[model samples]
Target: MTDTFKHHLELLIACVIYGTVGIYMQQLEDMSIGSIIFYRIFFGLTALLFYLSITRNLGQLALKRKKKYLLLLGILYVLQMFSYYSAIR
Candidate 1:
């Protein structure tokens, strides 16, 4: 398969997985929306960290290029998420 095809397929799968998780999040009736979002992010990060550790890629995070660009992107992502949650509420 071509690299472009594989990348698009991966993006599709990621969207499906994210949609599935969002559906499940709505069923947690006892938790506040904030708590649900917190758990979702915490678990997602934990799983990502575990995967990186197992793959020995955790060390590469410190050596990534364009640190300022990445930091800006991270901040933008957080702001986007906050805006999304606010809109949902």
Candidate 2:
């Protein structure tokens, strides 16, 4: 496949995966919102690490600078996810 086709395919797959998150969350309505968010982040981080290992890009994760900024970004991301899941719940 050409690069354009491959990119589009990846985009489409990502969209499908993202679109199903709400359905999955709804199905797990019995679980606490914090538990749901934790599982989501855990699985997402696992998947990301797996992908990085497979693509031999693990070295890219090394923090060369701006440690404070990275921490801030992570905090923001957690807050965002918490708000998002809370809203959906």
Candidate 3:
């Protein structure tokens, strides 16, 4: 597959994984919703960071990206996560 095609395929797989999270997460007991959210974010961040580093995209991303957009993205991510956590709780 082409690089762009592979990227799209990966995104599709990610959507499937996320689609199951709610069902899978609900099966676990004795765990707080905060813990679930923390684990998801912590592991997801690590995986993305590792993928970027492996692809040598970290440096490229830093050089090519604007700081303002990163800040905005971060804010949006946090808000999305807060909403997800609220719904889960």
Candidate 4:
């Protein structure tokens, strides 16, 4: 396959995995909902940071220049997540 076709295939696989995440999340019976969400976010963030570090893209993020905007986005994201999980439970 060409590079473009390979990238599209990877993206399609990612979407399928992402779409199935909720089904897997519903299988955790022992843990509280909060614990489940915490682990999900923690591991997701860790994976994202690791990817950025491996690709040397951390510097490209330019957090210093975008600190204020990123902070605002972070707050909104937290609020949205809180509402989502709360509603689901």
Best by TM-score: 2
Minimum summed lDDT over a 10-residue window in model 1 is located at: 21-30
User: Which parts of model 3 are misplaced by more than 4 Å?
Assistant: 1-12, 63-65
> Per-residue alpha-carbon lDDT of model 3 for 52-76, expressed as tens digits?
9999888655546588888898878
Candidate 4 local lDDT, 1-89, one digit each (tens)? 89999999999999898667567657765677668667878998899999999998997766557788888998887777666655555
> Listing every candidate in turn, what is its Cα RMSD in Å to the true structure after a full C-alpha superposition?
2.7, 2.1, 3.4, 3.1
Per-model TM-score, in order, reads 0.68, 0.75, 0.61, 0.61
In terms of lDDT, model 4 sits at 0.77
Per-residue lDDT of model 2, residues 1-89, tens digit only: 99999999999999998768788887898998878878878998999999999999999999999999999998998898788888877
Spell out the clash pairs found in candidate 2: none
Instruction: Pick the winner on lDDT between candidates 1 and 4.
Output: 4
How accurate locally, in lDDT, is each candidate? 0.76, 0.89, 0.78, 0.77
Write the number of the candidate with greater lDDT, choosing between 1 and 2: 2
At residue 47, give the lDDT of candidate 1. Answer: 98
Model 4 steric clash total: 0
Q: Tell me the deviation in Å of residue 54 in model 3.
A: 3.0
lDDT of 2 at 79: 90
